[model samples]
Target: MGLSWQQGPLGAKAVGQFLTPEPFPERLLFVEPLRRRMRVRLDGQWVADSEDVVLLHEPGRYPVAYFPREDVTGLDEESRTTNHRDLGATAWFTVLEKKHAAWQHTDLPDHAKVLEGRVAFAWRAMDAFYEEDDRIVGHAADPYHRNDIRRTSRHLVVRDGTRTIANTKRPLVLYESGFAPRWYVPRADIDTAALKHVEGETFCPYKGLASYYDIGERKRAAWSYPQAWPEVAAISGWVSFEPDVVDVFLDGRKLVLEPGQGVVSHGIDRGLDPDELQERK
Candidate 1:
């Protein structure tokens, strides 16, 4: 979560409130410059490349990068029309026979003129998006987003009813932007018998894919990112329990999920198909 998505200041459930007299809009949209060189590739062809890009941030949505029309190429005439609740009529464009692969808000009001001459390509429609040599996965990188892991000696414990499923003195605490710190336990500290592999999975843009496990009668009581992204590779194969599902303790104190702490499952961004994400680095 950064700036707009999830629990950021512009998100619907912001962790902190704006101390203003006037009520904020029910839905807020922010447009700002993306000062990095962004390039798009499709079918071994360069579709768009721009150093002067703009990013649109709306509540509950990943930031969308818009490139200046002059920097883009191979876009055909508008193939379809749609409406953005705040941005008005939007024109969808096809590139290299990829129908409706890009869009531009052609009928923007004066307030949103900053995006008048720009178009944004659908992330999943393109072959790959690059910020220099690094291929960005899941979604565009939120500049304000951060993920940090810290090793701690806190007495972390997980329980299913009266049985202690996991107990550890050394655990890794993952601190992410605008989210609660998650504690990951070592695999050796957990009782392997207590975990029953569950069907289905989820993905994190920052942490790669997650596999779930059901403990006893509880469904999806624990999860682990077996092949986490290199940035957060320390917790690979380590398990993190759902506090609201099973009892968790840290430093001899019960860890209860407080109000507003729970978040909607982050199942990748921009409706990316799970099959397109198997080779994440």
Candidate 2:
């Protein structure tokens, strides 16, 4: 049977959810070519070539990159079947995890040790593993100026023996639902003397730029992914600190990050809302 397209509430919702006309940021376009070269070899077969995959995301779903059947080379012909189709003339591949194994071996790649202490990839599926450079990007497309909804609140205050020392309210909040929400405290609220300056930086296509500082005795300090969305450039928020390197506290309580739980690192598990997040954001 062939695929079909029906329009109504379903189509309208799909369009609203995935068809925003926001300008394609230059960084996003640059990463596209790299994606095609990124692929995973499972059971001696390559699956999900980034060149022709449909990336999807939702509230509680890991990003899904549906690949074309032709892109997946290996797997028995009997089980390889067409599931659905999309606007880009791409067909989705439906394969069983049990039918593949070579990629599931614990020691399939020895060079993996290079990432031993630093990063971990969570593969919930058997024979499922993503190649080293498999970075998939998702674009947020909605009719409502999602960025201007005004969902975050920021504060800067000094902790003084159970009392707030100096405090200021800044209307900057870094709230991205699927990812952790970073509450950016104002620069004035922080005790720069207590913060040991460090040289650390990271990038995000959605967010502009970022810089880090170590707080008190914490190895890694408050980070500000400074350049924010266009309409909310004034928002400078504090994203979480380096795991194990520092203990983050909101409202006097400490923030904890478990192994393999980082959004950018292991790519599995996310932190639920802490009462601190609600108060600070």
Candidate 3:
């Protein structure tokens, strides 16, 4: 019979026969070239440059790569650890292992699969902390979720003087629990002549780098940071847009979402969060 459960040394689930897990090598190189002296801290101990650091790619799990003994910042002989087999490989590393309920994939109900025509892929949001439950639980679109960032696209149609004009527009959505939703639009989608660069950039371990753009007459309209995590780099050209804050058009009409005063901005919310482990766990 096929393997039913593959548990790590510390009792976390490792791999299952039917699960779809990718190798860590599949990630994109860091936008700023990867540093040679890479060391990560695990619960206050340092695990340094050793040849055993192994990198693995995991979806939904943060820190896409799994570092071996040498790559960690704080790991030493004093750390009480165990080594064991979980299916085929030796599950190593003490401070880093998969967390419970953080990794589980059960087959979908057979009938639910038949009603939707055909589903190419099944996607779940990264961890509720990155995207909280108060906002949206999860959604499926096209073939991939990319970096777990939410996105919606529409073509703009407008009435110009006596003539009607049609323009294609795309917008990105960024939301946290109990916070206001922010929309970002591209210069091409809107009237770019009025938008100016704000001179700021932010980094997400899942999405990559982001630069800011502000609406000349309004505030920040759209921004794009070309470099992103290698796994879902396909959405690199896409920019985030604010739906309510900006007078941007979605398809033929302006999008009118329910005005919410309790929108949280951004941060890791553990109370309404999901499991995120950057290590072997």
Candidate 4:
């Protein structure tokens, strides 16, 4: 869960409500400058490049970067036209013989006027999206999203009823924005025999691709990032168990899963990045 998606402020289950005289609308959209250079690649060509990109944060959706039309090139407009309830009539564009690889809104209301002359490219359709020299995956990086990792000597233990699943004295605590802190245990401290590898996999924009494990009958009860993003690489190859599905104790205190902390990660069809989460890995 990040700032604008999932249960964050601008998400469907927002933690706070807007203060206004009249009842606020059920949905809220926030637009802000990315303040970084962004570029879009299509079939080995850099199609869009700009330092003046604005990101749109919509409820239940990943934040999207909208680039100034003047900064985009190497793309031609298509005949397809569609209606956008918020932005107005939308026109599609073709990139490298790919139809509808990009789009722009024709007219917008005063509140959304900033998007009138801007365009957004389909993330999966492009070869890659770059911030400076490094590439970004999953979706545009959420400026408000944060990932903090710290090494701790906390006594953490996991169990499935009477069977001890994992015991660890050294753990890394991951404090991600808008979610509960996750405790990742080093492989040396875990019982590898307890984990059963499954067929599913997930990709996190900040973290790397995630592979799940089943503890006996508990499906996807445990997970690990074999190749995590370099920013928070301390937890790479470490294991983490779900508090709601397994018993987890930290510093002798039993842990409980916080409400709204349950994440429903869908397989790629959720419009997740196609290739991988780690740009260089």
CA lDDT of each prediction against the hidden true structure: 0.87, 0.36, 0.33, 0.85
Candidate 3: residue 110 Cα off by (Å):
36
lDDT (Cα, tens digit) per residue for candidate 3, span 42-73: 23333233323222222322222222322333
Poorest stretch of ten by lDDT in candidate 1: 263-272
The segments of candidate 1 whose C-alpha lies over 4 angstroms from its true place after superposition are: 259-280
Candidate 1: tens digits of C-alpha lDDT, residues 101-150: 99999899899999998999998888888897777776788988999999
Tens-digit per-residue lDDT, 104-203, candidate 4: 9897888899887899988878888889987777689998888999989889999999998889888899999878899999888888899999987886
Cα lDDT of candidate 1 equals 0.87
RMSD (Å) of each candidate, 1 decimal = 2.7, 15.6, 16.3, 3.0
lDDT of 2 by residue, 94-208 (tens): 2434332212112223422221111112233323344344322222121111232244434434443354323445434444423333445555665556555577554443444
Candidate 1 vs candidate 2, lDDT winner: 1
- Deviation from native of the Cα of residue 187 in model 4, angstroms: 2.1
Error of 4 at 126 (Å): 0.7
TM-score of each candidate?
Answer: 0.90, 0.38, 0.35, 0.88
- Estimate the TM-score for candidate 4: 0.88
- Superposition TM-score, candidate 1 onto the true structure: 0.90
Task: Estimate candidate 4's alpha-carbon lDDT, on a 0 to 1 scale.
Answer: 0.85
Q: After superposition, which runs of candidate 3 have C-alpha atoms over 4 Å from their true positions?
A: 1-153, 157-166, 169-190, 256-281
